[model samples]
Target: MKKVFIILLFVAVSAFAANPDDLIGEKFIDVYGKDEKGKIVKLSDVAGKGKPVVVVYWAIGDVDTYKVLPEINKIGKKYKDKIILIAPLLSVSDDKEVKEAKKLLHFDFPVWLAGSDSIKAYSIEKVDVPYILFIDKDGTIRNIMVTARDLKKIEENIKNLIK
Candidate 1:
């Protein structure tokens, strides 16, 4: 019984010490496009008042996103008030491309048009359509999810930070 209690206490202490939610309180930001209708929406101001801000860097023309975006949309809606979900279309080829992609996505989340410089800063070299980054209310970068499965980890991280 003594040995078992010691082991249990050790486990609990380790669990409490290692918090992945430490990703919160870090600072990072990506420049997004504005106009409120295109691939990117530029942030005129920084951070938020109460809720965490989630900005996803995605290119609409990719088919992967077509299947995955709805999942993202679902999560976005679930935490809408708690999170500011913004998906910026990183590939801004032309007006026609932007228009077509928007028609297909029909996403409720705000789609911003981002320039190459902004995209490069994020180191988004791949065509991965569903990259999500969470910036906490105080302007700290909490977490980043580059795929749909990563959403679960991001969600869990958010719950910790929110409370």
Candidate 2:
């Protein structure tokens, strides 16, 4: 029992140490996922480009995802040329599910099917829904918002990142 307790304690510590919040101000890690057309898309492909990238990590049936994605899509449209927006569906593997979710969500942005690998890279395996990462042109994560639904504040962050 003592040995089991020690192992559990170590696992808890490791998980906390790998928190995604620690990624703020750090160089964004490159992760690969499938685009709508089943083509592989790398985070590096969109990020480090000449525009700020907004990565929204969402799931299929999360209420917060449903609530915030439409608003985020508006921002994506408003700054379509100035910013790169990508919504990566966590834990979703099937392409048909992605298409259905995209239609139901009504988000106009690019939706990628982020599998276990991408989710693990982002350290969001146990994190809440609607996890947003704002990456600047240099591929550095500038800001992170977890479970945030405030559209104005989100837009403000995008504008700041653009400038």
Candidate 3:
């Protein structure tokens, strides 16, 4: 039993140390979204210099998730031209409910509809509703915020990257 416990702890620690920064500088998956003008936009085009993007893959009914929109926008404002908000509004649960949630965000940022493959490529499996990913200008996902408590730390990390 003691040996088993020791192995379990080692596994947990290893998993925790699985390099949170692993996704940086990777080629982006071809994620797609419709522009406000009803045109499809792909993630490839968003990759550019002088900009680090925040990609939020959020579902509709997640009430707490929606609250972060404004705060994310604040970060966007801080970096100004250096920040891109690519929040893909998905109907992962309530298809009809996302529109209102989208409206509530009042975001001037580009909102897209992510396909299942894109979601999976970014590891969007958890039921946390509003999981956020941060990608630098080179299209590498620098970090994934596992909880809302991680937001401030995520912002600070982005600020450092932007500079």
Candidate 4:
């Protein structure tokens, strides 16, 4: 029983230490998923490269997700030359739905099919829609927002980070 407990404790500790949040200051996990075009897209491909990236995790048909898109769209256009915006719709595994969402949302940014693997890689907990992460040009996550209540603040941060 003592040996079994020690093994279980070691396993639990390793899992806990592997949480994706640990990648925040280090590097953004290169999650590969399909885009609206059904092409495999990697997060690292869109991030870094002397531009800050804003990644928003949303769900299709969620009102809150729809609500946040306009602001994100505006920001994307305003920072078109300096920053990159990406929206990864959660729980959406089909290319057809991704294409439909791209048209419906009229997003300026790319919409990706964020699968279960992406979710686990982000270490997302029971969070609300429009979970946003601001990654620096160096591919490090600088800010994270679980809610969209403070749009002005986030936009300011984005502008500052991109500069």
Candidate 5:
């Protein structure tokens, strides 16, 4: 029994240690969501267009997630033509909620209503709010920021991928 317990502990630790770096260089999985006008949108449609993409996962009521919107907005504005920014609101289905969230957040980037498929695809089911994924122009995930609010570092990642 002790040996079995020790093996299980090792497995759990190994899984935990497999961090976001493991996902780097892997092709980003495509996700589908709805636009502000209830039109269906796919991640592939907007990304991989000869420009880097910044995907930010957020929710309406999550304060930490929405709190970073202003910073993200500034980044979006600064890199307006250089990068494509997508804000996917996880678990948010209603268009009314999306509109309200937009009004409250005041972000200029495109917002989408991300469903379970998107949440699961990104492996953020158990992660905290304000998760970010930086994908290069080739659609490969270059970096990931989980629950991190470092705007400068995020901007740096974007800058590195821009060219």
Candidate 6:
């Protein structure tokens, strides 16, 4: 019994130490929404396109996330040709809010007004502002970060995905 308990503990620790990338080899769930231009876009369209895609999930009220908007925008423009940046504003139910956000963010890439269906498709339950999804060219989600506090980590992930 003691040996079995030790083996179980080892197994648990091993599982915990497993890399996040190893867990998501399949294609990402398709998330659809209208961009600031009122044109529809789908994650499926960009995924597997031989370029990395960064999807930022944020809400108007998330102050921290809002603070990082400029940085995210910079990332988008800096890697425009190498990758795709998609910012999805959560909890926005109308076009008016999207307009306000668009004017405020001024992101060069697409700023999508993600409706309930888009949020549901991602299986997001809470308003974890600044939630980020790093997807590879193969349509696999390499990382899902719930906060934007550590920009270096995100940058590193982006570099890895592109490289």
Which candidate's lDDT is highest? 2
lDDT of 2 at 89: 85
Taking the tens digit of each residue's C-alpha lDDT, what string does model 2 give over 1-163? Answer: 9999999999998877667778899999899888989899889988987789999999888888888898888888999888999998885458788878778888878888886776667777544778889999889999888886889989998998999
Report lDDT (CA) for all predictions: 0.65, 0.85, 0.66, 0.78, 0.83, 0.76
lDDT of 3 by residue, 25-64 (tens): 5655667766555577777777554477777776655666
Model 2 clashing residue pairs (backbone) = none
* Candidate 4 residue-wise lDDT, 1-163, digit = tens: 9999999999988787544446557777788777877788888887877788988888887787777787788878888888888888786468777767767877768888777777777766545667788899988888777756567976987887777
Report the error of model 4 at residue 146, Å: 1.3
Task: Give the range of the ten consecutive residues with the poorest summed lDDT in model 1.
Answer: 17-26
Ranking by TM-score: 2, 5, 4, 6, 3, 1
5 versus 6: better TM-score goes to: 5
Against the true structure, what is every candidate's RMSD? 10.8, 2.3, 5.1, 3.6, 2.6, 6.2
Candidate 3's displacement at residue 71, Å, is 1.4
Which stretches in model 3 have alpha-carbon errors above 4 Å? 1-25, 92-99
Candidate 2 differs from the real structure by a C-alpha RMSD in angstroms, to one decimal, of 2.3
The number of residue pairs in model 5 that clash at the backbone is: 0
* Colliding pairs, model 3: 25-140
TM-scores of the candidates are 0.69, 0.88, 0.71, 0.79, 0.86, 0.76
Q: Compared with the true structure, what per-residue lDDT tens digits does model 1 show for residues 52-148?
A: 7777777755677776666677777888777777767776555666566656666677666766765555556555456766777766777766654
Writing each residue's lDDT as its tens digit, candidate 6 over 1-163 gives 9999999999998776534245466578787877777888788888878888898888886787768877888777777888888888786556787667767866556678776765655555455678788899988888877766677887887888889
Per-residue lDDT of 59 in model 3: 62
- Summed over model 4, clashes come to 0
